[model samples]
Target: MSSWQIGDITVHRIDEIPLPPETGAWLLPGATPEVVARADWLGPSFAGPGGELHLAVHSFAVEIAGERVLVDTGIGNGKTRANPAWHDLDTDYPARLAAAGFAPERVDRVLLTHLHADHVGWNTTRAADGSWRPTFPNARYLTARAEDAHWAQGELEPSRRQMLDDSVEPIRAHGLLDLVDVAEGGTELLPGLTLVPTPGHTPGQFAVVLSSGGRSAVITGDCVHHPVQLSDPALGSCVDVDPAAAVRTRTGLLERLAGTDTLLLGSHFPAPTAGVVRRHGEGYRLEPVPSA
Candidate 1:
């Protein structure tokens, strides 16, 4: 359970699922040495004989000025995704929201960092007739217009296309999609929240920045997936659309983030998610908020 307050806004993390070994391995390739050296610190980092890996899923919620905003809905319940573990349209996400002092209907906006299945899973819910519908009926679903066009071009890998259909199309079909352009560095989405373009993971991926009372926090979607990447910006995820571009973006972003006192929110970092970047040797390190 990770919660942090910035001015009048409160951010919370709501976990929905975990990735299997194979999926995890796909994300982190050199797991053996890292896992062994950081055994006590490794939450779920591991690799099997077949070179599989483990990963976790987390969704975040932001409450500002009494308005509820959800960021990156985790792999939702009963999503017909390519991955078997992501299948299943039945879960008490709504109940979980209520437990966190929120209701599904109260959500004012759903901002997707990107359109990956895991990130956009909860954008919609399974309807009575077995059709998937927008989960937050009244909230606007925000996504980068460039990303929408890139994935919709029908030239991506088959699996990527499938993810777009299930995770993005439904929101668009419901007339709730807000395809915003994120090319001018950043765009003000809400009063205190801004979308800062950090593309490369996708053609239009962006990070969410919340500024209040002279303090700021950035939700780094996939710009810096793992801590190790901070040490090797040249090392990028296999799924990166343009690895070289991603390296440049990561390097510059890390520099900008480290130069500020911004509290960093990683979409997939071990819980609490609040941290700050600091210059370490030739790379950088994340200093998370102290656990209670």
Candidate 2:
């Protein structure tokens, strides 16, 4: 478990699992061995010495104002995903959460950045009776209206269809789904936490911004998947719905975040996911928090 404290809010990263090199390359088409070697800073953490990249499918547990809010539930257990690697996962995610002191029933709010399979999996779980049920029994599952409508058009892939049925629809049926509009400025979720539109990877993607005691941090949701993107803002993910738009959103985010004290918490980055963005030669670089 990796964690960071921002003012009164404490954020914990619970890893659902780590992605292998082949899977990472499939997700990031531009990331070849030669290309990865350019970002020397990724060594041993985000990238192996042999240029194999490691990515994490994890959730951020944000404890603020006495409410436990989970950002982006990682791929869930027993999910019948289309991707072979993700299909029928039998990991101990709930046990991991409990190990980190975040019991399922104790989670009060669950925020989905977008309706991607990996991001929304744990929204619900399969009961022993084989019925899909909300994992967080009492938490309100927050989703963007635009995201739901976009996926509802039936244009999504087969895996996404399964995701909607098992992860998303169950939350709605459980009377815990809250659809909100992701606007330009921001949508305040809690007192100090806000959801800001950062589309590209998905039509209605939003990143969470936390500001408290004059300190700030951004919980990026696929807007900047890997730290290498900081050095090459133009590097786009193959999964991006709009590659060009993703570049623009990513570069804009990097430009504004560079040289700031704000912490950058990459959603898919490997262990020690929190970092600071700094302006490099022409683009930016991620300065990860020092290992303890």
Candidate 3:
């Protein structure tokens, strides 16, 4: 139960899933050996094949004042996703939310950084009738209008579309989807939370910037996947829609936030997801948040 306070907002990570070898290779090509070794060091529970790379699935929640805002609900249970591991997610995210001191009814909003399956998986859950339904009955599911339009018009490859349907459409059906044009800068959806466009990983990806008590934190959702990417901003996930644009966005975001008092919350960062970016030789390095 990791927690951090940025300004007046309290943030929590509710991880519900993980990445597989192929996914890890897609993010860091030759790091599979290193990744496997690191997993082994963590004990047999973390061990995996040498060629397989597994990344963590991290969902975040922000509590500002009395409003509870959830950012990026990880892959949900019984989802018919393209990725085999994403299917039948066994983790009880709702129970995790309760353990984190947030009841499902308390979530005021759900901000999806992008429509990626992993990020939006918990948007809905399987109902008693065996049909999919919005997971948070009280929360308004927020997404970018541009992203929805792009995927709606474009023909997604089979695997990708499977994710889109399970992770995105259920919210649409509930009419709880709030589509915003995040390309416009500094849109304040919540009191202390603002949407900052961080496109490239997806056509309309956005980062949530929280400010309170003279402090600020940026929830970086897939804008920069790994600490190594900070050293080589040019290296992006193979799934990036626009590789060059992603590099530019990542470089600019990291440059702006590095060395400041601002806290950076990386969605997929190992543990202690909050960190500070520091200039290191040609690029940057993530200085983990100190233990309280």
Candidate 4:
């Protein structure tokens, strides 16, 4: 388990699947190999031997004050997703969580930054009876009200809708959902953990802020995916709903976070995902913390 300490809270990474290296252009539209190659800092961790960008789909276990809060639920095992890469995954995610000393029933809260299919895939799991059920029966699911309302308008593609029906709706049906407003900042999740709005990738996307012992960290849920984006804040992912707005949100976030003491926990970044964003040249760069 990859773990980090920010004040009193302890964060552990529970990986569901690791995405293999791919050319920068394949993942982000404007990100060509030439563009990303300039980021010399990404080598060996965020990027591979051939300027291949590495990524992972995983959730962070945030433990603090007798609470075991899962930041985001990764793509669950045995599910059909529209995206082929995520379809019918059968990884030992629950077992991996147990290996990290966290059982499903012990989770207190399943907090989702948005309702993206990847982020909420493990909200529930498939049962032997061929029915889907909440994976963490003892936990309450938390998401933004705007996210639920956005899907309610039926603007998403069929695949996303299927994600809602299978992974999201089951949580609501089991009376384990709490929808909060993230328009003007966000609510206090715990005494020291706050949800701050970082919209544009999704209508109601938010990042978690942890403050304690004069140290801080932010769980950036899709606000920024890979370290390459930090080199060119204008570059956006093909999956971004509003590319232009995403840039604004991302640039603003970098401006506020760059050179600060706050550690950034990237949701989809590869190993050693926790880092400090620093202003570089005309953009920014991630200085990864040495892992334990």
Candidate 5:
């Protein structure tokens, strides 16, 4: 139960599952041992002693006033996935979410960075009749308009379509999904919570930016998937829709965040999860600021 306070906002990280060591190689092949070894800062946390990148599937829960908001839901339970690590099984994600003080029924918003199968898995859950249903019955699932549009017209892999049928389609069919138009400056979905456009990973991907009083925090969707990207923003994920665009967005985002008080909350970062971005060598690094 790790939580952080930025001004009046309290962000809670709800754990789902940890990716196997091989996840680094499969997801970000460019982050080879030689590449990760160059950035010796990732050891024992983001990466292993042997230079293996450590990643996890988790979601961030934030409650402002009485409105509870959830960022990127992790790989869901019992979903048929192509990736062996994300395949059908069960985990205590729902219980952990409830324990974090933001149960499904209590969530008001589900903000998705993109429409990736992994990020949207928990959008729905199996009901008594065994039909997929929106987990947060009362929450409005939000994502970029561009994101939904792109996937709608595009030909998807069989597994990806299955993901949408169970997780995303149910929300849309239930009138629970909201397609938000995020401008260049970002849209203030809530008083203090802003959804900023960070396209590239997906044309519609957006990072959540929470600002309150003089304090601030930014949730990196897939724009900056791992801290290793901070060491080399050029490294892109295998699934990136626009690899080159991802690198550009990542490089620019890190530059604005570097040397600031803004807390960088990684969507897939391992423990000691929250951190501040700082200038390092020719790129940047996450200066871990352990949760309060």
Candidate 6:
């Protein structure tokens, strides 16, 4: 079990599955094999010998204050996604969450970084009657108000609409979804959990900031999908809604994080997912901190 501690908070990594090499190739075309090979600091953990990136689908089950919180549910079981890899997954995600002490009904809050198919797939589960229902019936599912506003103002493609219908809409229909306005600074959801605005990957994307005592850790949402972004924030993903804005958000975050003790946890990073930023040449790199 991969776990980490920050002051009084305990964060558990609830594994869903490891993403395939193709996922890296498709999501980040800019991080080609040649480019990866050039970054020697990436190997042995962040990248494979063949230069394929290492990524995983998992949720952070956090015990903070008195809340049982779940952060970013991974590509869920039975989700019919546009991406082939995310389509119709049947992983033991629920069991994993339970094992990590975050059974669906026991969750107090479901924090979504964005509304992407992967991030929201576990929002609902298919009922026996074939209707999607809120997975955490007792928890309040929260996301940036900006995310819903963006979709409401525009027409989503069929696939995008399908994802919402199965995952997001059901939660909203059941009155379990809450749209929180994350200001320029951030909105503290609870004692130690704060929603920090991080747009661009999606217009209303936000990273979760967990703090307690004097220690702090950040859950990097989609703002920085892979560690390669630490090398060059300009290396954006193919699905970025605003490429330039994503770059700016990432660069600013990394610049501030560099040389700090603040723990940087990559939402999709493989193993040793928590690290502290450090200046490396022109950009930055993670000084890996192994989980307990």
| CA lDDT of every candidate | 0.75, 0.87, 0.78, 0.86, 0.91, 0.89
Q: Which stretches of candidate 5 lie over 4 Å from their true place?
A: none
TM-score of each: 0.88, 0.96, 0.89, 0.96, 0.98, 0.98
Indicate the worst ten consecutive residues by lDDT in candidate 6.
Answer: 147-156
Superposition TM-score, candidate 3 onto the true structure: 0.89
**Between candidates 1 and 6, the TM-score winner:** 6
lDDT tens per residue, model 2, 11-44: 8898898876687788888878887888887787
Displacement of the residue 116 alpha carbon in candidate 6, Å: 0.5
Candidate 3: residue 83 lDDT (0-100): 69
Query: What stretches of model 1 exceed 4 Å from their correct place?
Result: 30-54, 156-158
Per-residue lDDT over 29-142 for candidate 4, one digit per residue giving the tens place of the 0 to 100 score:
676667768988888888776767888999989887789999999888777886677889988899989887779999999899998878999999888898889999999999
- How would you encode candidate 1's per-residue C-alpha lDDT over 1-292 as one tens digit per residue? 5678777788887767556556555665544445424332223332233433334678778887668888898888766666777776566777777677657888898888888877988887768997778888889889899888877775777766766677678888889999999866689877899999888888888999998888888888988776656555676787888878888888998888885788888787655456788876667766667422
**TM-score, cand. 5:** 0.98
Query: What is the Cα-based lDDT of residue 228 in candidate 4?
Result: 91
RMSD of each: 3.2, 1.3, 3.6, 1.4, 0.9, 0.9
Among all candidates shown, the one with the greatest lDDT: 5
Please identify which of the two predictions, 3 or 6, would achieve the higher lDDT against the true structure.
6
Q: Which stretches of candidate 4 lie over 4 Å from their true place?
A: none
Q: Would you list the rank order by TM-score, best first?
A: 5, 6, 2, 4, 3, 1
Cα lDDT of model 3 by residue, 1-292, tens digit: 7888886788888877667646767666644466445323322222245535336788888898688899999888887765677877788788989888778887888999998888888887778887778888998999888778778886778867877777688788888999997756668887788999888989889999999989999989999776556655776788889888888899999999888988888787657567888887677767778523
Q: Write the per-residue lDDT of candidate 5 for residues 1-292, one digit (tens) a residue.
A: 8999988999999989889999989889999999999999998899987879999889999977568999989889889898899999599999999998888899998999999877999988888899998999999999999999998996888987998898899999999889989999989988889999998899999999998889999999889889999998999999888999899899999999999999999999999888999999998999999998
The residue pairs that clash in candidate 3, if any, are 7-212, 21-53
